[model samples]
Target: MIQLITLDMAGTTVTDHHEVEACFAMAAQKSGLTVSDDRILAMQGLHKYFVFQTLWEEILGTTTHPEWQMRVDNSYRVFTEVLENHYLTHDITPTEGCLELFEYLHIHQIKIALTTGFYRKVCNIILEKLGWLEGLDDTHVGTASTTIQASITSDEVEKGRPHPFMIQKAMNLLHISDPQQVINVGDTPSDIQSGFAANCRLSVALSNGTHAADLLTPHNPSLLLGSLHELIPVLEDLRTRS
Candidate 1:
């Protein structure tokens, strides 16, 4: 039986379009980098540091240096300060049907794991802002919140997506020995790749994230659902078939 479900954050769990773009723009300017909305939107689903390095290099005509990394770090700290203290409070919110889905999964005795490319600090800030930290410790939630050195490290080969280490770590943390008994629900192609890397029994992509249905169709997900509202019904149908 599928006993665990690993979820992705960002566009998958919380909805915040303007806040993300505004922060990126302001951070880029403070770091002496210039960025456009199109570029920022195009790089959605990528890790924050990678996005910073990529955009900084693209804008400043050079790759990142240690000093540049420091600047980026400072800019990001300020950005996150604003995000957590203000923007997040005003902008970020959970998707439709998220609460109902969480309750259903809990009642079913299925473990819920949350994995993200983001470091624990940033993840904590967002989760705290959204009141997700409490849920992270619930019996049903398995979170990748440990120190990178202490925790099973996720690989970021050739970019974070289309690689599997993040999801694999989630499984390990959740004590899910059989990937075939776990399901992954995410909003990006990287999520699918992680599920495949972990050899998950099932992977479902949702249109509620960065990409639209027509765009993500090319990635060939096991199934595509419009929103979290469809999760229970889809799983019910899968159960019937089995």
Candidate 2:
């Protein structure tokens, strides 16, 4: 049986109306980078800093150049500002059926953990807007009365998506040792890749987020969902089979 369900924040549980991509585009433009929309979307679930670093390297054709770090720093700085302001000023809400899914997990006694590509400050901002941060400690670990059992951010780990550090850290905090007892759910390829890298029992993907089904399918997720509501039946089926 699955004991823990690790979910992605933006685009998965939280509604994302291409605002993130817009922020990235604005940052890239301000930093004088000629990145395309597809390229920006492709980097969607990665650490913001790393995304800039990689993009700068690709644009400059070498990481060793003196301007590379400066470009990365400038782009990331702008991105942070734009992203944080967007979340602070704009309306934030849970994705469709997110609350229902949370209720189902609660009833089934399955712990819910949120993992995000966002860093701490912005992540907290979104959570606060949705009131999902209530009752969580400084470390973002929730008690029995909280909405989620734990929350993990990319900044807290040495590496972000496509790496297992965040998920492993969540497992550690939740006292879950076996990946087989955990289900990873997200709406990005990096999220799915991270789950697989962590050896999760199921690396599920949602196609309605940042990327489309065609883009996420190449990552080979165990299951692909079109909406958050579809997860309940999948979990029920898993419980029965297990």
Q: Say which candidate scores most in TM-score.
A: 2
lDDT of 1 by residue, 1-242 (tens): 76777777766666645456677677767766667877766666567677776666665557645466666677667665654555435646777666677777676666666666555656666666666665344332433432111122122233465566666665666677888878887777777767777788877888877767876678788889888888888766766676
Model 1 CA deviation exceeding 4 Å by range: 59-75, 135-162
TM-score of 2: 0.98
Candidate 2, clashing residue pairs? none
TM-score, candidate 1, is 0.77
- Estimated TM-score per prediction? 0.77, 0.98
Q: Where does candidate 2 have its weakest 10-residue lDDT segment?
A: 137-146
**What C-alpha lDDT values do all the predictions have?**
0.65, 0.92
Each candidate structure's count of clashing pairs: 0, 0
Off by over 4 Å in 2: none
- Residue-pair clash count for candidate 2: 0
